[model samples]
Target chain A: MSSQSVVFKPEISKPLLQEVMDRSGQNVLACYQCRRCAAGCPVGDETGVTPDRLIRMILLGEKNEAFNNLLVWKCVACYTCGTRCPNNIQTARINEILKQMSKEAHIEPLNPKVAAFHNAFLTSASHFGRVNELEFMSLYEIQNTRSELKRGGGWRAIVDKIKDRAKLGISMMKKKRLHFKLDKIKGLSEIKRLYAKAREKSVDR
Target chain B: MEIAYYPGCSLHASSELYDIQSRMVFRRMGVELKEIEDWNCCGATSAGKTDDFLAIALPARNLGIADASGLAEIVIPCSSCYSRMIVSQKKLADDPGLKNTINAELIKKAEGKIKISSILEVLVSKANSGEIAEKSIKNLEGIKPACYYGCLLTRFPCDVEIPDSVENPQGMEIVCKIIGAQPIDWSYKTDCCGASAVINDTDTSLLLMSRILHDAVARGANCFVTTCPMCQLNMDAYQEQVGEKYGIQKRLPVYFITELLGIAMGFSPNEMQLDRHFIDPFGLLTELKLI
Candidate 1:
């Protein structure tokens, strides 16, 4: 372990700790830095900020650094970290709050593709009141293509990606899993209203 | 025994095989699965991550419908859907403010009375009670399966409250034993399959799935079984891709737990939609003379 000392500044630590506690309903102070969460985390190797490190960062008042980590975006919400936490800290739930806050604060996500996919899913749900897998996949691909083009992957990368998706699509079709028709639940208007209410609440927050 | 059924999006579409097999297995065992009418999406992890209220509200709507239908318990076949619905119900019950807001918005009160259960939970209980054992028409002694729970089915012990250990659940193992199949002991049972990231981050999902598949095969599992359509989809459909990426010729057939149970309960391979699997299980079934 590096012997770098963290300066405990109450000025920064107090409010950040309170905000996290309020939003997550988890006490950062309860975490004794046990690293149990990290040990059980399935994507610990793939994440920029491991679960233990994230807790430490939050406790240390490294608010921006903790919130902006790619791990928050990449977390599959598998609850492995939460389940393994000896302190019952619910690290996965905390990560979820951090992700929501990150979105609200407009922190540039390290993984835009995942964010895009989420937006596509929400859009599909808002429209149909249920997820149309084919529609969601198409919307996700379109958003992914735009992101790839913006990242300068150019036309060839986009073409290759579409080709791959097309192959998968065909395979799913062959299995009769991919339906061409759009599916909507009966209470579309009720779902739309709920979305509107959620948006209002989100804006209020 | 009649139980409210919530098929969610995947069961209605991509994982229709799971729905068919589960219904068939339950019907054979004298259980009536009444599909919840007009149930909406459970919002899953995607919506849950985007907005907490929407996530809860989406499933809350389904709970309200189930509650109105007078079903005390709702059996969800998909693990992801079960997790969302259960978590949402708990959240709604715990927070009256959130529940009131959702109730006001949806024009339905989410009373949180309906207990959400995974199909595995329901089936395992039946197995433990000897209902399934008595119903098994064929022995599965030839098949060795690694029962993969993935994440959602038994994650977060406080929330899910599954019958077995959350970290190393044996609900499926119990079911396998009841049906006469040997369930292999293996790690990575509760490991994440990277879920929706399968679409957004294919490489990461492939790597994760490869690890799970490799672990199962290393433990001498001839086939893999799961309850979640998302997990089944990733392991079954993308097994080839992961094998190609890792340069391993691991071709373990993935089956929904219900499919295996249905087979043992005298349902034919065609009824179980075994051919619908991307990695067709028929060859393995033939090899084991299970067909």
Candidate 2:
């Protein structure tokens, strides 16, 4: 915590705040720095970024600082914070919008695996019109392995990961939760078009 | 009562027991579930992070299909799916421009605005009206269950409108009482079980799950009754993992709320697929003489 007396700048760009409010339908300005959001957050203790702090950063126009924080990715999207907010700020929704903005700005998340999992999930859904759990896990593992190797962890890290998943994977397979074949929902073309249109619109934004 | 059923991806695959027990319980209650044709994934927590439009569009597509089915209401078994569907409906209702764009993009019209409901909501209403109590054949007086709501079921007060108090929900408790089981009060009832984090960040996810389990155990809960499949999977399948990590020997079995309801309704263990859980619940059922 900074002990220095805080100075408020008179002329601050509020584009990020405006965009967040506009996109999330949350009243970013209504937040009064009440720590109720942080108090109710389930993962608040695990991360350095609290819901109040994130809202404060946004209010202070620290868009880059707030967007770069790993807390954005760490949020479980549980909405505990939102439900507890006195002003109904919807802090979880703000975090989500920030996450999307971070991706749009091509900012690599501090937690790569979370982003990787999201990418793998969307990829699977877009292709099959539904999630194929087996395929999704495989793609996520492949991405993780590639990134690990690039970071110079080599085959040891890959082997370790496989070993970690081996027991659970076998159990899931035995229970018939995991499958060998890909399951595709009908009307793949419609889903493909939706994905294409979303991509096009996101790019336009 | 007849309603459109949206099982989502998890129900069709990983969480098939939830689907089975849900159908069985509802069937016994004379509620007919018409499965939504060509329903896709709700995108869970992934789509919103990857793409905003797809997040809303995926669930909206299902809502459109459900509306077209002539059903005025849709019953969603998974809390996550319920949240996504409700949120999507609210988003479309709030933003006509976005809804228009999505409709144009998908080339399908969303008509008649179908209502989305969670399985808990449906069951609790029946229990409140004495419908469940009338149907329940087996008494579960010996079972002490900690009803777990997780996050999605009662969060976002403005959007996901659960009938019970969001902070201290009683939907599951109502059903528990109707079936003659004791519902214990415990903290972390609405806490996140770290959902997908169970796959990506095992250590943190285990820690969250362990805390919830420890709390329920401290409150003298014999087992967990949950509405969400993700919560069941994390708490039930990972019970052994958490026990090993925390050096605790207590293995509390977790069951879907519908599974327990089925048991009370005189459905056999085989009918509910109770044997398929990672932690075998047979011992617990036997102790209560419910099998």
Highest DockQ among the candidates is held by which one? 1
Poorest 10 consecutive residues of model 2 chain B by lDDT? B103-112
lDDT of 2 by residue, B123-230 (tens): 878988888988989999988999999988888524556578988988899889888899998997988888778887777788888888889888999999998988
Candidate 1 runs further than 4 Å off: A1-4, A151-153, B157-160
lDDT of each: 0.84, 0.84
Residue-wise lDDT of candidate 2 within A25-98, one digit each (tens)? 89988888889988887777888789999988887788777887756878888888888887888888888888
For all predictions in the order shown, the interface RMSD in Å is: 1.6, 1.8
User: What tens-digit string does per-residue lDDT give for candidate 1 at B53-162?
Assistant: 78788998988888888988889988878888888888888889888888986755678888788888798789878999898888888689999998888785245566
lDDT value for model 1: 0.84
User: TM-score of model 2 relative to the true fold?
Assistant: 0.96
